[model samples]
Target: MKTITSIQKHKGTTPLTVITAYDALFASLFDQKVDIILVGDSLNMSFNAKPDTLSASMDVMLYHTKAVCAGAKETFIVCDMPFGTYTDEKTAIYNASRVYAETDAHAVKIEGGIARAPIIKALTQNSIAVMGHIGLMPQFVRSEGGYKVRGRTEEDIVTLIEDARAVEKAGAFSVVIEGVVEEAAKRISEAISIPTIGIGAGKYTDGQVLVWSDMLGFFQAFQPKFVKRYLEGATLVQTALDAYIKEVQERSFPQTEYTYQK
Candidate 1:
């Protein structure tokens, strides 16, 4: 399990690995294998069959975070502060502290850049560990008029750099840069001392994170360009299910090595 210091120290060294898990079963399987296990709000979409992460609430996040911690006791976990839960300093502290008191999560992740720096600073000052999120935040999808890939232009790259710097200055141990152009992601990584975890951002970040279902091929609704499916989980599971149904329908499943004849 990587600690805050260890995760930060990994900035220029080995690239860190992160993946999301919403339940104990998968968290146990991923335990000790990845650098961080994020109980991301992505569960709203992948597990709860929701359209986006905005509808995920604090209760939803905390419930899953506790389950993940139970399964990955040895793994470092980060709970995402769900939408509308951290809109202000008071709200941020109240909610973030709940994560610490309710579960063994090592940190809490919040989306925003320079604009949320004050909130981030407030959380850190109160002893809450924070991982900043920047560049095409999902929580702002509706407001931003949909998911937009950032850092495509030189000006946008500069803005992203500033966002990265502000986050670091606000005392974030690490930050996630998502949905940005490759070169701009590289530049942001160069500009920040804290570790940068990339999702759709690109390969040059200090670390990479992917939703478990996306990487394992379980979520078949759609595939993002950044998600590299390592397994055809849906196909394999369906095939197995088909075989089970065939055996059951044929009454071949209970052939019985020998049922108790008492």
Candidate 2:
């Protein structure tokens, strides 16, 4: 089982692989293959049919985390603290405690940096492991005015590196650099002591993560430029369903061999 310490150890030695899993079924598939199974709030769009992650509530995240933890007993699980839950240290610790206590997750990932450094420190000081998130924060997308690549400008790149340093200083076991320019993400990865996990942030980071649906082609929604579809899962499921429907309509589904013997 990969713990926070193990993930930290892999920083310069090897690149880690992380993927999102919203339920036990998917968790079971990649539990042993991947280094970490994250109960990401992207499930707002991936599962709840929401336009963004802001709609994901604590209850919804917990429901999925519980399911993931149940199945990935030997794998390290990280739960996302959904929007409106990590407002302050007290609140962050309160919510993080429940996540660790109830779901059996190994750690909690909180978005933001510098500004949230104190909150991260509080959680870590209280014995809760934390993973930091920077760059294109989905929770702030509405205010950030939409999803856009970060670290395109000098000021933005500097801020990103500063954010990485701040999170590292705040005691995060690892930090996720998302949707940034490849160069900037690479620089940040070098600047931080903890492992840097990238999501569309390029190949230079210590680890990589992707929404499982994006890589699997499980949904027909917008595809991001960074995602490489490895399998047409949606099409395969659709074809199977179509065949099932036809066989049922043609009254061929209940063959004699499929029935119970008298």
Quantify all predictions' global Cα lDDT against the true fold.
Answer: 0.95, 0.93
Compute each candidate's TM-score over C-alphas: 0.98, 0.98
lDDT string for model 2 (1-262, tens) is 9978789999887999999999898899998899999999999998788899998889889999999988888899999999989999999999999998788899999999899999999999999999999999999999889998999998999999999999989999999999999999988998889999999999999999999998999977889999999999999999999999999999999889999988
Structural RMSD, model 1: 1.1
lDDT of 1 by residue, 36-136 (tens): 99999999999889988999999999999999999998888999999999999999999999999999999999999999999999999999999999998
Clashing pairs in 1: none
lDDT of 1: 0.95
Highest-lDDT candidate = 1
How does residue 197 of candidate 2 score in lDDT?
94
